[model samples]
Target: MINVLKQASEGLLYMSESEYPFEVFLWDDSKQKDITPECVLQKVGLPVDTLVEVVELDSFFEVAIAEQDWHNSEEKITVKKYQHLVQVLKKYLFDLQVMRFGKINIDVYIVGKTSDEYLAGLSTKVVET
Candidate 1:
C-alpha cells in the first residue's frame, strides 16, 4: 500500500478494465455533479476491533491480471503495525465533528484523506448532479 500510495502521490494512477475487471458500478448519487470539500478531517487510527477488516490480497492482483474484488472484506486487522493510520483518520474526524458540526457519521471517519486518493486512482467516473 505504501508503494502504491507513493506512486500515486506523485500523480494520478489509472486502471483499465484489464487491470481491475469491474463490470459495472451503480452509484447512489450518479446525478450529483460536485462534492463539497468538508473542512473536517477524520482520522481513523490503527487496528480497532470496530473497523472494517482489511482483506488478504493475493499480490493485489489475480486473474488474467484483471480483478474487481473488494480487497477489504471480512478479514481481521491486527494492531501489530497498521493501527496508527486508522486512529489518526478516525479520531481526527470525530474531533472535527464535535468542534465544527457537533456530529460525525461513520462514513466521514472511514473516508478520511483516502476519499480523494480513491477517486483519483480508480477508473470510475463521477456524475454529481
Candidate 2:
C-alpha cells in the first residue's frame, strides 16, 4: 500500500482513524480535520486501495539515521529539515518515475487493490475534532 502523508504527529492519525476513512488527520485552528480520502486519491491520481503510504519524516529519519553506519553526531535532522528533505525527495522521485515509466504505475510498492474497494470499507461520515 502506498502511504500518503497528511499529518506530522503520529497520534493524530490514530485519534481520527475512528472517524475518517483514512488513518491521517490535519490540524487547523487547533482543531483536527479529517483529510478526506478523495483528497489523497486526487493527489496521487490513483485509486484509494492503491496503498498510498504516509511517511513521518522526523520519526522515520530518526530511526534510519541511528540504524545507518555513517552516523553524524554534529548534524541532526529536525522536523522542519526532515519535511524539506521529504518535499524535495518526493518531487525528484515523482519526476524520475514519470521520466522512466511514463506514468506512476508503482509508488514504493505494488498496489494490491483499487481505492474504491478500500473506501467501501471506510466510514464516509464527516466528523469534527
- Please name the candidate that would achieve the greatest TM-score relative to the true structure: 2
TM-score of 2: 0.25
Per-residue lDDT tens digits of candidate 2, residues 34-120?
334344454446665554444333333354234333545433343344354345434322211110011233232111112322211
In candidate 2, which residue ranges exceed 4 Å CA deviation?
1-32, 54-57, 64-129
The number of clashing residue pairs in each candidate reads 22, 12
The global Cα lDDT (0 to 1) of model 1 is 0.24
Cα TM-score per model = 0.17, 0.25
List model 1 lDDT by residue over 8-98, tens digit each. 2223211332212111111222222232223222121322233232221222222213323543432212121123323333333221111
Residue 75 C-alpha lDDT in model 2 = 31
Candidate 2: residue 118 lDDT (0-100):
29
Q: Please list the C-alpha lDDT of all candidates, in the order they appear.
A: 0.24, 0.30
